[model samples]
Target chain A: MLENFKFVLSHTTHPGNIGASARALKVMGLSQLALVNPSNFPSAQATERASRADDILASAQVFVTVEEAVADCRLVVGTSARTRTLPSQLVTPRELVELILQQPARVPVAILFGTENSGLTNDELHMCNYHVCIPTNPEYSSLNLASAVQLIAYELRLGFAQTPELPEQRILDNEQPISREQLSGLLEHFDEAMRKTGYLKQNHEKQIDIRMNRLFSKANLTHSEMNILRGFLRSVLYRCQ
Target chain B: MLENFKFVLSHTTHPGNIGASARALKVMGLSQLALVNPSNFPSAQATERASRADDILASAQVFVTVEEAVADCRLVVGTSARTRTLPSQLVTPRELVELILQQPARVPVAILFGTENSGLTNDELHMCNYHVCIPTNPEYSSLNLASAVQLIAYELRLGFAQTPELPEQRILDNEQPISREQLSGLLEHFDEAMRKTGYLKQNHEKQIDIRMNRLFSKANLTHSEMNILRGFLRSVLYRCQ
Candidate 1:
């Protein structure tokens, strides 16, 4: 799903911003980047800023106009610094993610970011169905061009990328929940141990039984946890004898 | 509430990263920044990289150790490159935001980022209640320090900040739904116009009425839309005469 997104920077002045934008996209698992009439290309400054994301810069497509850049895109989104008087619906970056999710058919989405000083031009904004504005400090909204790309790419990653399970979670996946029979046997063991240890008084036996059952159910003990508990119970029973 | 959160960079090597981090925080409407033994501060390079967020750099607190930096914080979250073999709960950036939302009392949160080469140390990870790992391309997870800050700050902003209404949406707030009586009158006008145009036949009058009613109900037309439709109907009725 992330492959469907292509970030298009139109007439970006800073070569470093272009490089940083490539790095940003690569870090978020996005590879496609389109340049529309950039001031400089194949610049050393860009490669230096890109760090090890030179591959993204190498594979980046360059076009003469924004029209050609997003010609094949199904959904064109323009990033604006502020709201404008236009028919295009304005949305927050977060809301834009939801919009993309709702419209799965709108693949090969192109997100347009204008020059550093000014955001998307009126003509570019007119082309977009929605204008996404990253919420910033009302006083100082000077977000770096690369930072803006990083922000939008981050939102798209969160929206579309499937989160891989942690190593610990994968390890724990091997341990299944104990069966009902195993749980009942463990409960019986607990009952015997409690009786022998004089913990389960005759008058409160029913209460203890109910509470223990509820506790075990709440814990949802796995096979490994049940083994540990059963071992502890066996030790307690041997000690009581 | 953003003021309650602080970004702490420990033993950072690059001054540019510090400056960029400050800019990142400011862009996301966060102020507090604490550095632990940075290689260089009060450097011209730092200010240059900070763009115009000099205020954040000037107010940044310098700490000798991570413990002292987070002493006042109610919650400490460590940003890690990968999950470790520790007991601390590991979570994605999105999950970390949800965790913060769940624990409203855990204010004054401190998010710790380790050196560029190495992420949070085991000792630092031990201090955190939760370790948030940004999901990146497994093959190339080389996210820049400031870029990482930007991504995390972006998520925090989206999680906490209330999205302001767009100017267009605010303008549309004045448009109220037409009254039921007005809708009925409009329906009557539509019926008369259809009859005059011979579009509504004797045998299919009920069908036309039902379809028109359903279409109008589905549209949920605003007062302005109602007025436009009424004007169009009036024009049609005059033409019939």
Candidate 2:
């Protein structure tokens, strides 16, 4: 599936960006890299920037034009920070992941990244079926090219990576969260501790009780966590006596 | 919130990683960057690697000690590859995001990343209450320091940048976590006061010490709470004096 996708850098001014882009793609298990008229390919700066990912730069496919870069691609997605005036489907990085996952078997999916200053040209953007925008602060939406690639690549990997299923809910039957009785017991323990510390001299007991209850409720304490708390409280009570 | 999260790298080996980390944080709308005991900062390697993210590097904070770097921060989360045998709680990147979002208004939160070859040492890890681990392949879990920073910074941005209704948990509402320095001061004050009252004459100090530590740790006293406790202790000390 990684081999089928092509990440094309269009008119990239810096050779270092190309190298960094290669590293980003390789980390996410995406290997195919196509460069459309990079300023200086096969340069020492790029190889230095690629670090351990030199293989990506070595085997990179160089193209003279954007048209040649993504001609055979089944789907093309261009990355942009601004909302274009043209009518094209704009999706966030996560949403683009969902789109890619829904059709993993598709061949030659091209991700287009434009020049550093202006981003994808209108004609180049028109070639894409969708535009992918990484959500950033509206006040300062300037994102580095390689970083943008890294994020989009990460989303792709997360969508494709095989992860272990999350542990199933461990709640026992007849136990809906913590019972009111158990909550009251926990509150009493807290109140007793406060009293020992001379913190609940007034009717502040009610406020302390309410606050403690809220704290525990937010924890959604598991059975084991609850046991630990109870054991600690018991020890405290025994010491106070 | 964005301005408050300072990404501090300690003893960073690779200048490129520093640059990449800057780009990572910028893409996520976080700006503050700090370097503690870096091997070589302000090198051309770093500036070139930073690409257009030189602004972040230009304004980066350089500190000699991690303590100094995080002195102003109220919350400190250390990024680790795996959980150590320490009693510190392990939270995934997503959970850490939630925790950071729940921090009280405008308090600084420091996210610590160690050198590239060997991640944060036991001493550094001990400084943090929670260890945030980014789930990576166990077989080839060679995540670069900057990549780890990228993932965590991304999660933090997602958790805190959105404009949604306030979370129901309100976990950090009233309990502000006490700093290690504050905790140390309180412990010293307790010891002195106990000695003044003859509560620690015959090795009873050990038992009382353990109990007091547990009590304060469980309470999760904030900065203000620590001040209050110190104020109370001062009054008692005055009476004894």
Candidate 3:
């Protein structure tokens, strides 16, 4: 559900913020990034700031305008640090999350963030179904662009849990998420199969095993998913023999 | 309600993040920010990033360690982007907000955000009553330092609104917070009385007044308390006269 949301930054002036926004989106498991007429993109500074989040920047789609960036999106949300006399429905980030969850069918939702200086232009706000103002200190509300993105992204990630219980899956009921102990067994199987298949050379470093553990840990594999993977590993070993 | 919360960023590497963090806190109407052994501070980069919110940076209290930063705080909450094997009560950001609001009496609450590369060390995390995660993308959970503070500060603000009218506030009704202006007048009275009593010397710099403000700010004084202070000040003046 979170993957369908694309974070769109319009007329961003700093490439570093662009990079930071990418990192923020990725941290929350949201992948889509759209930049509308950024000042300096594809720059070294942006890359440096992105760190391991380079994949997000590399795959980031650049569009000519906000409309173009969110053309396919059904639900558009524009973030502003200050409240303005506007027509769009105003909601807090959490409220926006509840609003988004009401219609699960809305694929490819777009969350818009304006340039650092001024927030979304009037026209852009008009386009959004909802306008979100991060309740900030009225006296000193200079929220950096990427910081705004990070908070919204965090809220979206949270909304994933707040959403109404997902329709039950037939397979999921019988197969709970596998325990870490079970996952470790799967890794050992992979190590044995890979070693016999000459996939891992003699005197192979433990780094490969460590990475396999990390990769599987992220999979959040279910019991059935674990069986399928283990079955595939057995087949590979049989073919090698 | 939000005044008791204090944000602590530990072992921070970039001064810019520190300045950004100060802005983050102030914007949320949260005034307290404590830094633990930052790599660089009072740096030009931090000042530049802070923009007009330089006062938050200037008044920011620095400490040599996390323990010292949070020593005065009763409820310590640590931020973690990853799931660890530790035994602390892991909660979503919203849950932490709810928990903090549950006990309105827990003044000087500390929320700790660790360094950039690594999150809070096990020792540091153990110190927290709750381990809060912002619920980021599991694939790449690398939230920047100041951005982390911004997200937490934003939640704390929202939580303040969501918090059911604090029950303790009923007992505190007679002690409703006095404005900074009122607090200032009380400080001036203290200064004159102390001077008359041979404590403050002639042309003493404003350091004593500054310390008094810090002291009373923590007191969260009520209207009657302010009146008592003023009455005491009047008695002292009469004696001096």
| lDDT over C-alpha atoms for residue B139 of model 3 | 57
Q: Please give the lDDT score at residue B154 for candidate 1.
A: 76
Question: Where is model 3 more than 4 Å wrong at Cα?
Answer: A161-241, B161-165, B169-241
lDDT score for residue B9 of model 3: 87
Best of the candidates, lDDT: 1
lDDT of candidate 3 at residue A210, scale 0 to 100: 56
Residue B190 Cα positional deviation in candidate 2, in Å, after optimal superposition: 7.8
Candidate number with greatest DockQ: 2
lDDT of 1 by residue, B16-79 (tens): 8999999998988888999999999978888998999989999999999999999999999988
lDDT of 2 by residue, A25-77 (tens): 77666788999998888899888767677888889999999999898998999
**Ranking of all candidate structures by their lDDT, best first:** 1, 3, 2
Q: Candidate 2 on B140-236: residue-level lDDT in tens?
A: 3456677777777777777778856445545464465666466656878877755654445644555455445433433445654565445544544
Q: Where's the lowest-lDDT run of ten residues in candidate 2 chain B?
A: B210-219
Give the Cα error of residue A63 in candidate 3, in Å: 1.8
lDDT string, candidate 3, A105-212, tens digits: 887899999988988888898999888888787777788888888888887877774433222223434246678899889988877765655545533447566555
Q: Write the per-residue lDDT of candidate 1 for residues A105-210, one digit (tens) a residue.
A: 5557889999998877765665565678887776678899999998898888877887442123233532444443455678888787666655554336654554
Local distance difference test, each candidate:
0.77, 0.70, 0.74
